[model samples]
Target: MEIRDLTPAERRVWRAFPRGRRVDFTDRPPGPERTVRAKVLRALLLTQGAADGEVASLRMTAARITGRLDLKYATVEHPVSLHGCHFDEVPFLYGARVRQFNLQGSHLPGLDAATIHVDGVLRVTGCRVTGLARLGGARISGALFCDGAEFGSPGVATALELNHVSVGRDLYGVGLAAHGTVRLNGAEVTGKVNLRDAVLDAPGGTALNAKLLTVGSNVSLDELQAQGEVRLHGARIPGQLGLTGARLSEPGGTALDVGAVVIGSGADLTGLQAEGRIELHDATVTGPLDLSRARLTAPGGVVLDATSLTVGSNVVLHRLQAEGRVELRGATISGQLNCAGARFTNPGETALRASSCTIGELWLREDSLIEGAVNLRRSQIDMVHAEPGAWPDVVKLDGFVYTALNPRRPARERLPLLERDDDGYVPFAYEQLAASYRRIGDEAGVRAVQLARQRRHRGTLPWYARIWGYLQEVTVGYGFKPLRAAAWLVALLAAGTAAFGLHHPPPLKPDETPGFNALFYTLDLLLPIIDFGQEKAFKPQGGYQWLSYALILAGWVLATTIITGITRALSRQ
Candidate 1:
C-alpha cells in the first residue's frame, strides 16, 4: 500500500503494510487516539472486502480502541472478533452480513438499523450498549447471545422491533433489553430464551409484543416486568414458559392474551399481577398451568376468560384474587384443578360460573365464597373419559355467609326453596325440600319425590328417611278430639244422675227405700255431709253418704272410656 497524505494526527498510527505487519504504540498518549482508531478500522474494512471468500478467520485479539467505528454495508466474509474494545461514539455496523460477529465486553451503542442480518452467530456478551438498540426485520440465522449486556437508557419511547427473525439456537437476551420495548413479533426461536432480570420499561405502551412468536424450548422470564401490556397473542411455545414473579399489566383490556396458543409444556406464571384481562381461551398446554398467587384484576368484566383451554395437568390458581368473573366455561384440565382461596367478587349473575368445564378432582376451597351465582349447570363431575381423574361434585364454601337482598319468594312458586332453578341447591337443597314439605304438612309432595327417587333407582333414598317422610306427613295434619269427648261424657253423666235415681228399682213404685227421693230426703236431713265433703276428705257422717262417692267414681270411669275410644278413632282417620 502507498503512503498517502493522511495528516499528522492520523499518521501516528499508520496502516499495516500490504504483506501483514504490526504497528508500535509504546510512547503514545491518548490525545489523537480516535483519529488513529478510525484509520485502522477503515483499513480493516477494506482488507475484509478484498479477502472475500479467502479469509476464514479475522481475530483481533485484545484491542482497545476509542473511536466511532463505521462498518456500514461492508461484507465481512469471515468471523470478526472485537473482544475488548471501548468506543466513545456510536458504532455503525449497519447492514453488515458476517458469518459470526463476536463483540464480547465491548462498550458500544446507537445500533439503530434495519435488516442488519447476522448469519452464523452474533454474540455480544458482556457489552455495555448505551442508547436504544433496534434490530427490526433482521434474520439472525444462528443463536443471538447478549448475556450480561447492560442497556442504560431510561427505557421509554424506545422501539426495538425484532420482527420476522429466526434464530437457530437459543436466543439468549438475558439482561438484554433491560429497559426497552422488545417487539419480537412473528419470530422463531429454536432453543431456550432466557430473559431473566430484564427490566422492560416501555412507557408509551407495550413493553414486549411477542405475538405470533414460536419457540422451540423453554422461555424463562423470571422476575421480568413489562410495565405495559405483553402482547403474546398467538405464540406457540414448544417448552415450558417460566414467567414466575412477572408483572404484566395493562390499563384497558388484556395484558397477556395467550388465546389460541399451543404450549408444549406448562406455564409458570406464579405471582403475576395483570391489571387487565388474561385470555387463555383455546390454548392447549401439555403440562400444568401454575398460576399460584396471581392477582388478575379486570375492571370491566372477567379477569381470566380461559373458557376453552386444555391443560394437560393441574391448573393451579391458589390464592388468586380477581375482581371480576373468573370464567372457566369449557376448560379441560387433566389433573386436580386447585383454585383454592381464589376470590372473584362479581355480583351480576355469577362470580364463577363454570357451566361446562371438565376437569380432574377440583381442589377448590370450602371457604371460597362466591358473591354471585355459582352456575355449574351441565358441568360433568367424575367424568371418566373427559379429562383425567374423577371430576369433583363437592365444592367447599367454608365459613361462607351471604347477606344480599334477594327476593323472599323463589323463582318457581310451585317448587320449594330447594327446587327452584335459580337457587343454588347443591346437596342441601334437595335435602331441605324433603324436610320442609314434611314440615308444612305437604305429605303428598314429600312422599312423591321419595317414591319417585325410589322407583326410579334401585336404592336411591335411605329407608329411615322414607319412614320419617311418612310420619312427618301425619303429625302436621292430625286433629285433637280425645279431650273434647271426655268433656261431653261428663256432661251426659250429670244429666242422667239428675233424671234417674241410683238405688231405686225399675219394677218398684215410688215407695222404694233408699231411692233418689229418699237419698235427697236424707241429704236434706244432713246438709252437713255436703258442706263436709268440700273441706274434709272421707268424712261421710253416715253409710248413705258412701253412695255419693260410688256414683262419682262410676261417672269418671265412663268419661275416660268414651275419651279413649274417641282418641283412637281420630288418630286412625
Candidate 2:
C-alpha cells in the first residue's frame, strides 16, 4: 500500500500524530497523506495469522499509537511500537515481530502460546506481565524478557530460554536449556521451582548455574529427573529445597552440588534417588535438614558429604539408607543426628565416618550397625544409644546413657578382670559383689562392703604394720595423767626398800671377823626416811617399760583430733 501522493486532509493528520497507538477516528479516507498514514498504522498493529500477508517496511522517522494497538491474529511486516501505551488486557503477539522490537513501557495481561515462535530478539524491558507467562509449547530463538517484570501468577516456560535475559518471578520448567547463562539474579518467586522432568544444559561446567539467585520461598524439583547436572551452588533460598522425587544422575563429578549455599529455613532431599554425589559443604541451615527417605547411590566413595556445616537444629537422616560411603567430618549439630531407621551398608572399610563432629545426641536404633569402623574420637555427644549394639565398636556409645540397655557383650567380653595378685582397683567388682551378695541375701553386707571398698586403698600396707605412727605422738615424761599409774609403782618400790632395811636388815654380827655390818649400812643410807634391808629394793630394776605404752596412747589420740579439725575447715573453703 505505497502512497504515490496524498490528499490535503490526509497530510494534516499525518503531520500531527501523537506518541501512542492511533485509534480510528473515522472510516472515510482523510485524503492522500492521511490515508497513507492510516494504512501504515494498520500494517504495524495487525497480529500474525496463517493468511500469508506481508507489507512494505515503513520508513517513518518515529511511529506512535494514540490509542491501544490491537495486533491479534495479524502479522506485522515492519518494526512497530506501542511504547508508553496502556493495554487493558493481553494483546496477543504470537509469531509477530519486526527486525528490532521494543515495548519498554507497557502492561500485558497474559501471554498464550501454542507452538508459537519468535525469531528476532523481543525486548519488553520494563513490561509488567500480569498473568502467567505460558510458553509451555512455544519455541523462542532469541532472548526473552520479563525481567524486572512482575507476574501475578505462576509462570511455566519449559524448554525455553532467554539466554542473556533475566526472570523476575518463579520460572517453572520441565526441561529447560540456555546456551548462554539465564540470569535471574534478583528474581523473587513466591512458589516452588518445579524443575522435575527438566534438563538444564549449560556445557561450560553446569547445565544450569543459578549462582547468587534468590528464591522467595520453596524450590521443589521432586522427580524433576535431570539428564545433565543442576548446579545451584550459591543460590539463596528462604525456604525448603524440595527434591524428594528428583533423580540427579549426571556423571560430571557431582550432579547436584549446592555446596557453600545457604537455605534460610532448611531443605529436604528425601527420596531423592540420585546416582551422582551430593555435596553440601559449608552450607548453613537455619532449620532441620531432612534427608529421610532418600536413596543416594553414588559411584564414588563418598555419597553425601556435608562437612563443616552448621545446622540450626536436627539433621533428620532417618531412613536415609545409603549404599555408598558418607563423610560428615567437622559438622556441628545443635540438635540430634538421628540416623535411626537408616542403614549405611557400605560393605568396604568404614561405612559412615562422622568423627570430630559435635552433636546434641546420636540415635542408631532399630537394628542398625556400622558394619565397619565407627570413629567418634573427641566428639562431644550428649546422649546416645536408644538400643544395644549388635556388634563391637560398630556402634559408638560416646554420650551419656539415659536408659541402660542390655550390657554390650562385645565391650564387656573384651575387658580384663582383676586377678588375685593384682594390686590395682578391680574392674567390674561392683557388679560382681552385688551378684554375690544377692545370691546370699546379704543386702546389708553388700552395701556396707561396697562403701568400704570404694574408700579403701588397694596398693598400700595394712595399718597394723605402722603402729609406731600412733605411738610416737604421745607425751612420755612423768606427771602426765595418762602415765600416773607408773608414778605410783615407783613410789611403792622406794617404801618397800626402807621397810626391808628396818625389819630384816643384814645381821650386824654377820661374818664377825671378815664381813661388815649390813644392818648398820642400811640404817646409814635410809636414816632420814626409813630403815632398809640389804636388798636391791630401793634401786628398783628396769621396770619403766609400762610407762612408755601410756605415753604412746596419749600422744596418738591428740594427733588424731588435730588432723580431723584441720580437714573439716579445709573442706568448707
CA lDDT scores, all candidates in order: 0.60, 0.50
Off by over 4 Å in 1: 1-31, 34-42, 48-73, 83-95, 105-109, 128-132, 150-156, 347-349, 367-372, 383-573
Q: In model 1, what is the error at residue 337, expressed in angstroms?
A: 1.6
Clashing pairs in 1: 366-396, 366-397, 366-398, 367-398, 382-391
Q: What's the CA error at residue 239 for candidate 2, in Å?
A: 1.4
- Per TM-score, the best of the predicted structures is 1
* Candidate 2 deviant stretches above 4 angstroms: 1-166, 174-192, 199-205, 390-573
TM-score, candidate number 2? 0.46
- Tens-digit lDDT track of model 1 for 126-206: 777777566666667889887877664674455455777778888887766546667788888888778886767765477
Weakest 10 consecutive residues, lDDT, candidate 2? 472-481
lDDT of 2 by residue, 1-573 (tens): 323354444343333333222333244443332223334445333522222343323223222323333444454544444444344445554544334345555555654433344454455545555554344333334444433443332222322222222333445543332332233433334444555544334332444455555666766666655545567777778787777777766653677777877887788887887766788888888888888888887643677878888788899888886766777878888888888787776764556767678778777775655545454544656655444443324433232122122223232222222222123454244434333444455554444434334333232446773353333222211111223333433443344434443444333345543333334333334232343343222231233223223323433444343444345335423
Estimated TM-score for each candidate = 0.62, 0.46
Alpha-carbon lDDT of model 1: 0.60
